[model samples]
Target: MEITLVEGDITAQRVDAIVNAANSSLLGGGGVDGAIHRKGGPAILEECRALRASRYRDGLPIGQAVATTGGNLPARWVIHTVGPVFSSGEDRSVLLRDCYANSLQVADVLAASSVAFPLISAGVYGWPVEDAVRQALTVLNAVDPAHVTEARLVLFGADTYTVAERVAAGFS
Candidate 1:
């Protein structure tokens, strides 16, 4: 797959699938999760509620992904994945990496050719931006998806984008 770093709103990205860095509740909290929910409209939430009532009664597990309609957003599907909170006492990097991997897996299952992702866990969840970039790139670089041809890491700010660009350079 072709991986790129984009400094912009993830919600604005025109792609087949957009990954949401969601809370376990899948109900929409803050940061990228809130943005996607608000912009995508009520259809997204309706699906989430159904998922909760049926399969995800206990809420989405960290690092696992599920799909919902993009609603008003440009993308056809929204892949929701819960990211692990950053912890200094224990290494949770595997969970973070799983978020990207599982999201891509879900996207491929949907036959999505392109995907856009936010830096999962880097905002309110307290993960450092640099490490988040590294984890995201690690999965995006290694995954050989059957349908996904492009993956864009959409950074919300210039500083975050710069960090992603620097980390992505090492992958080259």
Candidate 2:
């Protein structure tokens, strides 16, 4: 898949799918999760509630991903994945990478051609920004999805976007 970086709100991306850096709860929290929930409207939450009631009675586990309606957002679907929190004492990079990989898997299953993703765990979860970019690219670059044609890493700030662009250049 072709990978690109965009400096903007992920909720505004007009793609086949938008990935959410969700907490295990999946109901909604701060940062990207809250923005997606608020902008995507009630329909998205309704699906999440239903998922919680059925498949995810406890919560979405770290590294796993699931899909729901995008609702009012520009994207057609939303892929919610719980990112592992940054841990200086232990290596949780595998779980972090799984956030991107599993989300792409879910998108492919939904037959989505394009996906937009936020920098998972880089905000409130305290993951170092540069490494977060690298981890995201690591999974994204390796994937050969049957349906996904493009993946956009949507950065919320100019600084983050610049870092993503610089980190992305290394992959070239």
Candidate 3:
């Protein structure tokens, strides 16, 4: 897949899919989750509520992903994945990778050629921004080229987007 890095509001990206850095509840909380819910409108929440009532009553599992309508947002669909809380005592890197991996899996299932992502877990979840960028780039770089034609790292600030650009450039 082709990985593009940009500092922008993910809600405005006119892509096929946009990944949500959701909490397990999937009901929408602060940071990226709240923005997506608020901008995407009630249709997104309605699907989330239904998902909770059926498949995800206990909440979405960390590292796993599911899809909902993007509603009023520019994208056609939202791939929601709960990222693990960063912890120093454990190797949560795998869970972090799964967040990106599973999101891509869902995107492919929808035949989405272009997808945009936020820096999952780097906000209130307390993941280091640089490391989060590295992980996102690494996982996205590893996907089968045919599975996704373009993957955009839709970062929110100059610092985060700069780091993502540097990491994407030097990371093998």
lDDT of candidate 2 at residue 18, scale 0 to 100: 99
> What are the per-residue Cα lDDT tens digits for candidate 3 across 86-154?
998988989999999999999999999999999999999999998999999889988884557999999
* TM-score to true structure, per model: 0.98, 0.98, 0.97
lDDT of candidate 1 over 1-172, digit per residue (tens): 9988899999999999999999999999889999999999999999999999999999999999999999999999999999999999999999999999999999999999999999999999999998999999888889999999999999999899888888888765
Q: Candidate 2 regions off by >4 Å? A: none
Of the pair 1 and 2, which is ahead by lDDT? Answer: 2
CA-lDDT, candidates in order? 0.95, 0.95, 0.93
Candidate 1 segments whose C-alpha is farther than 4 A from its true place? none
Q: Write the per-residue lDDT of candidate 2 for residues 1-172, one digit (tens) a residue.
A: 9999999999999999999999988899999999999999999999999999999999999999999999999999999999998999999999999999999999999999999999999999999999999999999989999999999999999999999888989874
RMSD of each: 0.7, 0.8, 0.9
In candidate 1, which residue pairs clash?
none
Q: At residue 146, give the lDDT of candidate 2.
A: 99
| Clash counts for all predictions | 0, 0, 0
